[model samples]
Target: MLPSASRMRRGEEFADAIRRGRRAGRPMLVAHLKTREADVPPLVGFVVSKAVGGAVVRNRVRRRLRHLMRTRLTAIPRGSLLVVRANPPAASARSEHLATELDVVLDRLLRGRRSESRTLTDGRS
Candidate 1:
């Protein structure tokens, strides 16, 4: 289970991350990431809509994602907001596959952020 302090609980928080964050999509899920300057712990939220399945299936997917994120919390930067929105395919995806895709997406997002910061600091237009 994700710690309460690290879980995103408000609508505005989710909206901000989804609207302003960098996003990456996979067959199973889409991830949004926004880095902030505050010194708080990273916050994570999940979106599992009816398109994914009924309550049971949606809850299962959410639980799996929470478990996956628990192990990956350290990899996310402090003060960052991450939202993982599940695709319909995620309803049937294996745990390992979800973990793999989550890792790949996160690495891609973090790498992109790093390069973007480098470009801004490199003094080149």
Candidate 2:
């Protein structure tokens, strides 16, 4: 389980991330990440809708994704929020498949952040 501070608990938080964040897509999921100014650690939320599966399959997928995110929590930068929405394919995906997809999306997101920060710094002087 993720620590309380690391879990996004409020609907507004999730909405904000989805509304203002950059997005990365995978075969099984879509990730939206928004960087914040606060000093708090990153917060994460997941959406596994009924389209993904019945209760049992959805729960299983959510559990797998939760564990995957927990292990990679350190990779999340401070003062950012992440929301992951699972697609129907995710209900049938193996853990390895989910992990690989997650890695690809996260890498893209992090790379985008780095480039944006570089552009800001380069324009400054």
Candidate 3:
């Protein structure tokens, strides 16, 4: 499980972030990330809608995503807010498939961030 303070729980705030954040997509998930002025580590928000399945299924998906982040997201930079949404296909995905997909998305997001930082530092668009 991710630490309490590292979780994003506010609905309106999440909506705002999703609207403004940079996006990275994969087969099983979509990630929205915003760079914040806060001093804390990344605050992640996970979205698993009812369309994924019944109550049990949604919770399972949420749990799996959280676990993936707790350990894997360490590579992500600080002061970032990340929201990951589950698509309908996630209802049928096995844990291994979901895990691999999350890893791929994170990798892509981090790569984008690095390139963006270099661009900013070098005065390139």
Candidate 4:
């Protein structure tokens, strides 16, 4: 279970992250990450729509995602907002597979952020 403080609960929070964040897409899920300058803990949210499945399947996927994010909280940057939107395939994905996909997507996003910051510091586009 994810800690309540780390959860993104409001509609605007989710919208801001999804609209302004960098995105990494996979067969199982799409992750959006928006980093902030504040020193607060990272916030995470999940979107499991009906396109993924019925209530039970959506809830199951959401639970799996929450558990995966709990273990990965430290890896995310401070003051970042992350939204994981489930693709239909996630409904049937194994926990291990979801973990792997999440890791891959997160690595891409984090790496992108790192390179971008490096470029800015180096005075290059």
Candidate 5:
């Protein structure tokens, strides 16, 4: 289970991340990440729809994702929000596979963000 402080519980928060944040996708999951200017602990949310599976499968997948995410929490920037949506493929994927995908997508997303911020600062300095 994620620590309550690190979880995103509101619908609007999820919507903001999914609709306005930077996104990265893999065969098993899609990650939407939104950054804020303040330095606070990052918050994370997960979505596993019916298309992914029934209650049992969805819960299982959610638990696996939650645990996997715990390992990567430090990688997230302060005050940022992240939503991880599991696709149907996630229902059958092993935890290791899911972790691999998560790492890849997050690396791509965060690496791009770093370069973007650099460009912005470089232009002004």
Candidate 6:
């Protein structure tokens, strides 16, 4: 399990990730913030709410999320906070399902963002 400090988004950060971040879907939201002058960026936190379930169930979801992130981190952009919200349907979601969903959304979001940045960098408006 990821440490709480490393696994949970606080109130303001969570709100920012929701409101300003580029959302991948209903199940996940992601926002990237550059580190304060560092080459290596750390994955900060992931939040799964009680609306997801009781303690045991919520923690299970979080663990699944962390594992997915670990496996797929290379595809994830640097300095990003990924907030994966659990739908009620996900309470019983299998590990493979959870991993696939996270991978799909993160890959799509990252690809779109990188392509847009490339276009802008190439002087396209």
Q: Clashing residue pairs, candidate 5? A: none
lDDT of 6 by residue, 1-125 (tens): 44443443477656655666666764533333322223444454566678778999888877777776665665545555556666766678788877777777776667777887899899997
Model 6 lDDT at residue 68: 69
**Candidate 4 all-Cα RMSD:** 0.6
Winner of 1 and 2 under TM-score: 1
Q: How many backbone clashes does every candidate have? A: 0, 0, 0, 0, 0, 0
Ranking of models by lDDT = 4, 1, 5, 2, 3, 6
How far is each candidate from the true structure, as Cα RMSD in Å? 0.8, 1.5, 1.3, 0.6, 1.4, 3.4
Name the top lDDT candidate: 4
Q: TM-score of predicted model 6?
A: 0.75
Q: Give the C-alpha miss distance for residue 97 in model 3, angstroms.
A: 1.2
- Candidate 1 Cα errors over 4 Å, as ranges: none
Candidate 2 residue pairs that clash: none
Rank candidates, TM-score, best first: 4, 1, 5, 2, 3, 6
Cα lDDT of model 4 by residue, 32-123, tens digit: 99999889999999999999999999999999999999999999999999999999999989999999999999999999999999999999
Q: Estimate each model's TM-score.
A: 0.97, 0.95, 0.92, 0.98, 0.96, 0.75
Can you write out model 3's per-residue Cα lDDT over 28-117, one digit (the tens) per residue?
A: 799888877776788889999888899998998899889888997677667788899998788889888988888888888788888998
How big is the positional error of residue 82 in model 1, measured in Å on the Cα after superposition?
0.5
- lDDT values of the candidates? 0.94, 0.92, 0.85, 0.96, 0.93, 0.62
Candidate 1 backbone collisions, by pair: none
C-alpha lDDT of candidate 2 relative to the true structure: 0.92
lDDT (tens digit, per residue) of candidate 5 on 1-125: 78788999999989999998999999999999999887779999999999999999999999999998888999999899899999999999987898999999999889988998999989953
- Candidate 3 Cα deviation (angstroms), residue 106: 1.2
**Top-TM-score structure, candidate number:** 4
